[model samples]
Target: MSDTSGSQTNITDGQQVQLLERVSVAVVTTLPCCVFLFINVTMLFTLRSKPVFCETSRYVLLYNLLFADTVQMALGHLLYLFAACRLFLTYPVCGLLILLACFTTTIAPLTLLVMSLERYVAVCYPLRHTTIITIRNTGVAIVVIWAFSSLNILTRVLLLLEFPFKDLESLQMKEFCSGVYVLLGPRSKDYDRAFICVLFVSAGVAISFSYFGVIIAARSASTDKASARKALNTLLLHLVQLCLILSSTMFDPLFMALSGILTRIVFVRLYRVLYIFISLFPRCLCSLIYGIRDQTIRPVLMQHLCCGFLKPAVSNSK
Candidate 1:
């Protein structure tokens, strides 16, 4: 009897420990997410506050990129909270969340692709850049990116026809809500892998090409050395950002493979760490990179970030 009682106590203690750890992880992840969301929102407002940002082609593209990333970050964080809380949402609800998440996730790389090409044009053909990258074209490009991503989402929804949700006792999911559970069919998996591969590879090649083009342009006698250098740095940053964004998509499969080798406790701990780095960190990169690097945006972003305190001083100085 004493042995059985001791075992029960140990099990209860272990469960409590797990619960505490889960809560701790959630708090740690969420605090940074909230901070980034605040900064991103401020940056978005800063972009729209000035006429120059609205009129410029690159700023327009940056707005689109940042918008998609902000949505992605929010959805991803919400989904993470859902999983952390062990909430099993119904299929329809989960599907909507997952689809929205996937849609925004798809936009990041594609936007980066467009932004890279924009930089390439700016550096390689400075005279033609203004004509080629106009407001109308930027708007059209954003529409194309959204339309393409919508097609992918539509295909995934169609693939759901194969899932026999009718066989289940309820629409409520048996497991925690996630892309892995939501997309169970073989075709969905194959399609997802193929689509991700094609999208990332194309973006990678385009960005790389733009990087090289900028490097070559930098050496030319006619090229503005400073502009070429800046474009090179921007392209390089885009490549790094692309890789970080890509890492979030790859983490699930990698973690799944690691699950077999690692114990549950270790796996959960490692997953949280990777989740912070892979998922959360990448989403914040856009604001941090452009907010600090872009001279035009820095002062406005700072003013907004400081809650307009700098605005009065700047006006007084002016």
Candidate 2:
């Protein structure tokens, strides 16, 4: 309801619709971003103190994915916070950020796909793991995925920058969303349907298939039945989580393809709301997965969270 920069916002005084929606998004965005931010920053600093002995591509991919999600959740959500605080700058802000978010959003699934492939290599070709897979190589590949994703986003941003957005009430910062990234004018509106379809489909398919291959390869490994079972169960949980995250992205295109106006409105609103909440998951869940599920990683987290505190206590008592 408060437009700080005087640039015009979506909701007017009498219209109570978007005001409530914006408030809801702000709450969800703020709470989760704070929690995930703490977890991610804590993990980054503790990585050096306790190292995981293995040096596989998947290991490196895991850390890099964390790094990427931290950026997306912490810094990216901060962008929304700024837009909320300074609503008047919505026009140019919308212009600059929407395009950049395209890249950030795109790279997430791509990184997941890379992780899946690395897992596949580690399991399927265990003998060739050292020869074929390296952390440095995975890091380079991550850079490549980021570069490729950025290429598309930069192009989208360039296309969007040329358009003249008059700033419609529903398009700018209203209730359901904080950032001006979704602002759609006559020219810019082309982005919603076909464009999102391409980006989401490609990334989702890549991620899904990569994991599918990993699951298959893991099952085929010669590890003991008990170890294989544990690995499969863990991988299944990861798959379900990844699916939830990827499926949420498809909502945009799905909404666009719908024929009914009411359905479209409801879906788009849901899309924006889900977007704010879902983006936080990978950051926190990645930490939990690496820390809780894997015998290899849980100790590292425990050492950092527990040993760091307990060591000095025992020493002082002695």
Best prediction by TM-score: 1
Query: Lowest lDDT 10-mer window, candidate 1?
Result: 309-318
277-306, model 2: which lDDT tens digit per residue?
565665477776665666555555665666
lDDT of 1 at 206: 99
Task: Provide the TM-score for each candidate, comma-separated.
Answer: 0.91, 0.67
Error of 1 at 108 (Å): 0.7
TM-score for candidate 2, please give it.
0.67
lDDT of 1: 0.89
